[model samples]
Target: MGFESVPSLPLEGLETVDAARRPVPASPGTTTTPGAADRAALRTDSARANGAATASPAPPDLKVVPLPVRRAEPGRDTPAAGRSSIIVLLQQVQEQHGYLPRPEVVRCAGEAGISVAQAYGVASFYNFFKLTPPGQHTIRICQGTACHVQGAQGLLERVQSELGIQPGETTPDGLFSLETVACLGACSMSPAVVIDGEVFGRVTSRQVPRILARYRRRK
Candidate 1:
């Protein structure tokens, strides 16, 4: 039987048709090259995937700086410089009060920015600073080396007996206060006694009553 023959397709055309029908599998080591738009889309997807990791802001810089150290300078305004001023204030208080009164000393300490104990220490350390009030008249007996050798003890005893008071004591009448000093600067006249700023040289124990009588008469 004689039949009509159809045209046979080319091998390349068949390969093209097969490729359109089903995708060709890539070789093991081969990679597909991407176009510009495809590459850009891929980059956008990658950025979106890693957005959480790269979206945070950078941390701030922290630097530690040390403060400057201050040193005290010597001047009239400083604490050490105020020492002389405090002493002067104490002296003024003594001059007005005749002695270092406890209240006045406390006030002075406040003004000087010092402790009460410190103020009292200064008051007690010096021989001139008297803590008690003075009597109407003050009597000082010298007990220096020269005076002691010249029977100053006997004279002091006589005065105490006559006044009915011991050294650093005030008479019952408050007319006189007795005090013994290391020296009266009258060494040339040993056994010197000073009553109300009057210095009597080489005094004897017998002369005690007469010397005391003069002050009594004045009172």
Candidate 2:
């Protein structure tokens, strides 16, 4: 579903930042914590409960087993195949899957000869890699010092209201995502927003609707 823009309140006076002073985000890790453990716990508990309730013979106990390093098949090769580094393996995985699919990550562990837990740890440690699939469009709001002084905060709130989702969340239908960046290096475009890589400079809360509507129309 698309979002409807709320009427913007006026910012009396604010100064926009210059592009020259903007800094590169350089946020390589852009990492987030994974909920694999929680999922596993829930699965295990449900399985245990189900087993106890059944009158039939219970299944054998589950055991933790280390996965052996195996060559990835012809169509399943990790990027930089010959490398054994976990980081390299994950990079390859992210390159292919966009986000780290749990099954693909497990397969990666098998190919890299590392435990699944170890691979997940590595992926979760970095911020740049995403653990979940992203939406069709990505919207980045710059919240740098200059932009903030220019009322970037209100811009952010407007975005949140329009999207009906927080920075890390995707809409129910996965149409769009909202995220904040320290800077997009377009300080001159202070109070700027980037949607699908197109920068909108000198943006005001009032202009958000027109800019966002352009994308909504695409749907």
Clash count of each predicted structure: 0, 12
Model 1 regions lying over 4 Å from their true place: 1-86
Cand. 1 Cα-lDDT: 0.73
lDDT, candidate 2, 123-145, per-residue tens: 77665567878888999888888
In model 1, the Cα lDDT at residue 16 comes to: 18
TM-score of 2: 0.56
Summarize candidate 1's per-residue lDDT along 1-219 as a digit string, tens digits: 012233332111011122222454677966544564366566667766887454332232344344342322233134543343456678998889878889998877777666678778767766566677877889999998999999999999999889898876788788999989888999999899999999999999999889998999999
TM-score of each: 0.56, 0.56
Q: Which pairs of residues collide in model 1?
A: none
RMSD of 2: 23.0
lDDT of each prediction vs. the true structure? 0.73, 0.70
